[model samples]
Target: MGDFLDKRAEHLSTGMKQKTNIARAVVHQPDVVVLDEPTTGLDIMTKQNIIEFIRDLKADNTPVVFSTHHLDEVALLCDSVCLIDRGTSRFCGSIEAFKEVGQSGELNDAFMNIVKQGTMHV
Candidate 1:
């Protein structure tokens, strides 16, 4: 723990900060983990790493709730997603179900389709 801090505590990038936050959250071995915008400001490779890490955690039966504006990230990392727009739950379902909402095969497109349906304030 101290070694991790010594290595990453100084001059951390946004992605590194997010990773540190995740490490801190999981260090105690909690039953549930909730992350908000976990991949914001990360490069593609870094995002992939974070997604894989979360997947591993889930495989270990750790319940994780991640919030992000990146619908593609949600598609890749979430088993189920609840899309909130203007503080309202506009859509909630499995990623496959959400994908069926759009023809473009993109989660962001599906999300936009649902949002355009007038259920959400945004």
Candidate 2:
């Protein structure tokens, strides 16, 4: 905290500032956490570290809601997915179910199909 702290909040690099913000979020041990694109703009190593942190949170049975454009991260960390587009939810189900929506059985393809169809399933 001491090394990263800056009076003007500009001394720290983007990654360091992101880490500091993350430390603040977890300091309280809250039951639920909502992280929006936590790995965005981070280096690959830092992104992996954050991903591991998220897995640790899951192991602790803490609920984490992460909104990201990175489908790979979703595959790694999420069991369920709610895909929303244009302020509407297009699909909500397990990751397997999501993959089943496409002929290729790939999450990205399924997502594209859902967007093209503009439909939702419970």
Candidate 3:
């Protein structure tokens, strides 16, 4: 994007537009940052870059709130999670605690169990 700094967003590709939006969001260094599906359609390297960027934010003590359907992303990036089912929050807690409740000690299994029970614990 070094050469794209002068370009208008309307002329940008979808991926570039996504990056631009993210840049806009954090330019002011807000207390909390919220992103929805930040890496859904990005290329592999871009996705990894975004993950590392989030990690940098975490290191800087920035509280990031991102919504992603990718469980693998959650496992990699989240310290705590809020599991929502049918527009309702079923669980919210630390990742370790969440995994401990599962039979196999796997996050996906615990998530499934929570979804199955529809248990409400916010």
Off by over 4 Å in 1: 1-11, 101-104, 120-122
Maximum-TM-score candidate: 2
lDDT of 1 by residue, 92-114 (tens): 77777767754347887877888
Off by over 4 Å in 3: 2-11
Off by over 4 Å in 2: 8-11
Candidate that scores best on lDDT: 3
lDDT of 1: 0.77
Give the clashing pairs for model 1: none
Global fold similarity of model 2 (TM-score): 0.89
**Which lDDT value does model 2 have at 54?**
98
Query: Model 2: which residue pairs collide?
Result: none
Candidate RMSDs in Å, in order, are: 3.4, 1.6, 1.7
Task: Give the lowest summed-lDDT range of ten residues in model 3.
Answer: 97-106
Shift of residue 66 alpha carbon in model 3, Å: 0.5
Give the whole-model CA lDDT for all candidates, comma-separated: 0.77, 0.85, 0.87
Expressed as tens digits, the lDDT of each residue in 74-98 for candidate 3 is 9989999999888998888888877
